[model samples]
Target: MSFKITIQPSGHTFPAAADDSILEGALAHGLLLPYSCRNGACGVCKGRILAGNVDYGEYQDTTLTHAEKAAGMALFCCAKPLSDLVIESHEVSRAQEIPVKMLPCRVEKMQKVADDVMVLWLKLPANERLQFLAGQYIDILQKDDKPRSFSLANAPHDDGLLELHVRHIPGGTFTEQVFTRMRERDILRIKGPLGTFFLREDNDRPIIFVASGTGFAPVKAIIEHALKIGFQREMHFYWGVRKVSDLYMLDKIGEWEKLGIRFTPVVSDEAWHGRTGFVHDAVLQDFSDLSAYAVYACGAPVMVQAAHRDFSAQRGLQDDAFFSDMFTFAPKQ
Candidate 1:
C-alpha cells in the first residue's frame, strides 16, 4: 500500500509506498527536504505531522523526544506513512541552506582505477551523515599542511560513503600519502558540502556537461542525481583525457548512455578512434547555439576559462547559463 503525502507552504505532494521512508519518497519525487544522517540519529529531518499518522521507525531517543513525538513531530528519515499525510518542511533549494560540517571520517575503501587516479571512499561515524548538493565538494583537512579539496563523486542519495577521486600529484605530500601510505580505516578530517556547482532544476532546458581528466568527479554526481530525480531533459557528457588510459569509469558511463544520455570521450595526447584535441573544442564542433541550454563544465582552470570564453562569446550562450568548478592542484610542500 502507498500513502499520499503533502507538504505545507510549498504545497507539493508525492506518494510514499509502505516500505518507503518519507525522505526516500520525497527525494525520489525531486522534493528537496532538509535532512542529514538518514538513519534518524540527527534531528535535522524532524517535522510536524500536520495530519494523519506515521510508523515513526527506529531513532535515537535524544534526537526525537517523547514529548515531541506526542506533539506530532517525527523524523522524516525514519517515518513511514500509515495513512494519507500532511507535513511541514521547508525544502532546500540553495547551497547555503545546507549546513557545513567538520567531522572525522575513516578511509573505508580505496581503489586504483588508473595509474595516476585513486578513488577513496571515506566513511563517517555511524551516528552521523553529511548532507550536500550533488555537485558540491569537500575539504580533506590535514594536520600540518593546508586542506585538499576534491569534488564529491557520489550523489546525495548514495551518501553512505563519501566518494573522492584523487590524482597523485608529484611532489604534493597529501596525494602521495593517498598513493603510498593511506590505508583502510585511517582517519581523516573533512569540512564541506561546499561550492555552488549543483544542478538547477527550475528550468526544463537541455544540459551539456564538460569534464577534463579527474574533473569527471562532480559531473558524475550531478548526472547521477539528475537521473535519480527522473529529470527528463536531454544531457550530453564530454570527458577529456590525455590518453586512453586516463579515462576511467567507462562502465558507469555506458549505463548512462543506455539511459539516453550522450557520452563523448575526447583524447588529447594520443588518439585511437575518438574525438581529439581539447575537450571544449569537441563541444564547439557539435553545437552552434547554446542560448537555450545550460552548460556545466569542470576541469583544469585553463580549460574552464577557454570554454567559458568561447561558449559565451561565439556560441551565443548566456553568461548565467554557464556553471563551472575549476580543479586547481594544491601547492607542493
Candidate 2:
C-alpha cells in the first residue's frame, strides 16, 4: 500500500510507500526536499503535516520538540505517512533536479593542504563518469555502512578525477582510515552529486563567498568553475580559521588575488598578525550593502546559521539570497 503526498507552496505531488518515510519516498522518485542529516539530527527537513497522519520514528527532540509536533510540524525524514497527506514546505522545488549515484573510485593522489587537512583526488571509472554541479558533495561508504560526505574541491571541467578536502578529526571513523589506512589505487565506494548548495549562475549578481576550515572545498570548486566559464561577476572570498596554520591554502588565495579575485583571510585566535575577527564580520565591514549581492556560506553549523541570520537581518541581504551548507561533526556513540 502507498499514500499520495502533496507539497504546497510548490504544489508538487509524489507517492510515498507504506513502509517508507516521506523523504525517502520523495528522494526515491527524484524529488529534492530540503534536508540535511537524513538521520533526523538536523531540523532542516521539518515541515507542517497539513492533511494526513504520520508515525515518526526515532528523532532528536532538538529537531522536533513535543510542542512543535503537537503544532503539526513533522520531520519528513523520519515521518512515515499513515495516510495520504498534504504538506507545506518551501524547499520542494529543486528536489527533482539533482541526481544521485553510487560508483567505485580509486584514490589517485593525496596531498596535505593544512596541518589537519588533506586533499584527496579520486579518479572515477572512465566508463562511469559522474555528472555533478560544482558545489555538490559525495559520500564515502564506510565499513558499518555509515557515509561520510565531502564537497568536491575541483571544478567540473577538471574531469575524470574528483577532488575533496578532508579534515582529520581525531577518533573519527572515516577520517582515521583516510589519514592512516587509505592508499593510492585503493578502491572506495562513493554515492553522490548530493545537496543543493551549487551556484545559481543565472543571476549576474555579485557574489560573497564565505568559508571556514575545509568548508572552503566547495567554494573553491565554484570559484574555479566560475573563472573557467568566464563569469564576470565580482567575487569576494572570506575564509576564517583559528590560527595562521589553519589557513592551509593561503598561497592559492594569493594566486587568485593576482587574478583579481578579492580574498580576505580572517582569524579568531589572537596568535596571528592579519585580520583578527569572525569571517562574516570581515565581509560586513567591507561591504555594508549586501542587498544587491548573493552570499554562499559553508562551514560549522554555528557559522553558517550566524551568517544566515546576520546577513539577512543586518546586512540587507534578501533571505533567499543566502545559501549555505552546514558541516556537522558526527556524534560520538
Candidate 3:
C-alpha cells in the first residue's frame, strides 16, 4: 500500500510506499526535496512532520537529535511514512525541473589523475541523453542492488559523457572493481542527477569554492558551469592538499586563473613550501568580511564540517550562504 505525502510551501504531493523511505519515494517519482548523503548522515534532508506518523529507520542521532524528534522533525532519508503525511521543506527549484533517469553507461576511459585518484569517463547511451547540473551525482548500481554514489566532475555542457573522480579506497567494493576488474567498454547501470549541490545562478553573491583532494571534482564543475554561463560575480577557489602532487589538476586551474578566477592552493601538512594552513583559513585571511559571499565546500567530512562551523560562527557568513557536501566512506567489516 502507498500513502500520499504532501510538501508545504510548494504544495507538491507524491506517493510514498510502505517499504520505501520518504526520499526514495520522492526521488523515484521525480520530486526533488533538498538532500545529501541520502543515508541520513547529513541533516540536509531533515524536515518537519506536519502531520502523520513516520517510522525513522537506523540513522545517526547527531543528524536528528532527540530534541528535533520531539519538535516533529525527522530525517526524510530514513523516514517511512505510516499514513497520509504533510511535510515542511524548501523544494529544490532545479531538482524539480530535471528528469532523473536510469541509463546504461559504458566505461569510456579511466585515467589516473593522482596516486589514488582516477578520472573515470562514462559514455551515455547514444539515444539517451543526461541533463544534470554541475554539482550533482550518479549512483552506480551493484550486484546486490547496492548503489554507490559519485559526483560528476564535468558540467552538463560537456555532452554525452559523465566524468567522475574516483579515489581508490583500499578495499572499497566499487573502487577496487573500477581499478582492477573494470575495463573500457564495460556497461554499468546508473541512476542520477542526485543531490541539491548545484550552482545557484539566481544569486548574485560572490562565491567561495573550497575543495580538498578529489572533492575538487564537483567544485570544478560548478566553476566551469559558472564561467560558461558568463557569471560576473567574483569567484574564489581554495584547494587543500597535503603536497604539491596532490593538486592533480593544478595546470587546469592555472588556466582558469588566467581567465580572472581567483585560485588559492593550500597545504595543511607541514614540510610544505607554499601556503601552509587549512584552505578555509586562507579564505579568512583574505576576506575578513564575508557577509555577502556564498561558500560551496566539498571534501572530507572533517573539512566540510569545519568550514561550515568556522565560516558561519566566526567569519560572518550566513547559514544558508554556506553549502557543502561531506564525502563519507562506509564502515569496514
Candidate 4:
C-alpha cells in the first residue's frame, strides 16, 4: 500500500504509504520538504497535484479553496495518495532558499527533564512553517527588550513539531514565567533559522562534537541530521555536565551510539562513574592532533572559546574546521 511520489524540479522520488501524507513519506526517506504544521489546516505544504489520485484529508475550507483545488494544488500534509503521484513542490536544499519568518506559536507541551532544564514543544500557526537548518535557533519575541534565544533541539528530518531546550535562568523574566506560569497553548512570537551554525557536509574529516549544559541542544540537532543523511565521517560526541543528573536524553544518545557515533560523557561536579573534568578537556586529552577533524562545539561562552582556542592551537585543527554558536557572536573559523 505504498505509492511513489515524485517531486518536481529536483525530480526526487520517495514512497508514501496509503496512510502517509506526502510530506511525511518524503521526510522519512531523507527528502527535505518545506512544511510548518503537519496538520492540513496550514497550506505551507500546498503543492500542485500534477498527476495523482488523493484523498484530501479534512482541512479548513479557506485553507484549500475550490479555485485552488481546481488549479491542482493540494495540502501535502493532509493528502494521502490513492495511487502513484507526481507532485510539483519546491524542496529545501540550501539555507538561503529558506525564508526567515516571524510567526506566532503555542507551547504545545513542556517537560522538566532536569532541575533547571525545560523542554518545550512549539506549534506554529496553521498556515506557516519556519524552514531552518538543523543547528540553528529561534528568538522568542518578548514584550519588551531583546528576544530570548533558544536552540532548536529537533533535527530537520523530524520537524513536525519544533522542539527547544530552555535552561531556567533564575530571576529571568521569560524563563521564570516558563517554569512558573506558562501553560500549554500559551502564545509566543518567534523569528529564526537565525544562526550560521550547521553541518559542513562538503568535508570528509572526522567529526568531534562538544556540548555542555543545554548547549547539547544544537549539537543534538546536528548529530541527528548527520545520522539521517547517513553520516559519512567518524563522529565522536562529548557531553559535559555539572553532574550526572543534569544529563537527559540518554536513550537518544544510546541510539546514536548504536549507529557508530562514539559517546563520551564528562562530569565536572560531584563524583561520577565516567570521565571527569571539563568537556573540552576530555576532547583535548583524547585528541592531541585534530588537524583533519571538524569540531562542532556549543555551550557556555567559556567552553566554546576554550575548545576553539585549544583544539586549534594544540591539536593543529584548521581555523576553518571549528564551528560554534551562542548569540551568533562570531563566524565559524
| TM-score-sorted candidate list, best first | 1, 4, 3, 2
1-333 per-residue lDDT for model 2 (tens digits)? 999999887787888898999987765554557765566776777899999899988898887999999999998878999999999876533424545778888999999877889889998764455656778888888778778889998776564589999999999988888899988898999988788888787788899999998999999988887776567888999999987888877777787888879988899985576788899888878877899999999999888998988888888999878988888765211
Q: Write the per-residue lDDT of candidate 3 for residues 1-333, one digit (tens) a residue.
A: 999999997888888899999977775554557665567776777999999999998888888999999999999978999999999987666765666778889999889888888998999764455667779888888887778888899876554578999988888999999878888999999988788888887788999999988889999988887776567888989999877778887788888898889988898886666787888788878888888999999988899988888888888998889888778874211
Query: Using alpha carbons, what is the TM-score of model 3?
Result: 0.70
Q: Report, for every candidate in turn, its global Cα lDDT versus the true structure.
A: 0.93, 0.83, 0.83, 0.86
Q: For residue 299, what is the lDDT in candidate 1?
A: 86
Pairs with steric clashes in candidate 3: none
Candidate 2's C-alpha runs over 4 A off are 1-98, 331-333
RMSD of each: 1.9, 14.0, 13.8, 3.5
lDDT of 1: 0.93
C-alpha TM-score for every candidate: 0.96, 0.70, 0.70, 0.84
Error of 2 at 295 (Å): 0.4
Candidate 1: segments with Cα more than 4 A from true spot: 331-333
Poorest stretch of ten by lDDT in candidate 3: 324-333
Error of 1 at 201 (Å): 0.6
Candidate 2 RMSD to the real structure: 14.0
Output candidate 3 Cα RMSD.
Answer: 13.8
Candidate closest to the true structure, highest lDDT? 1
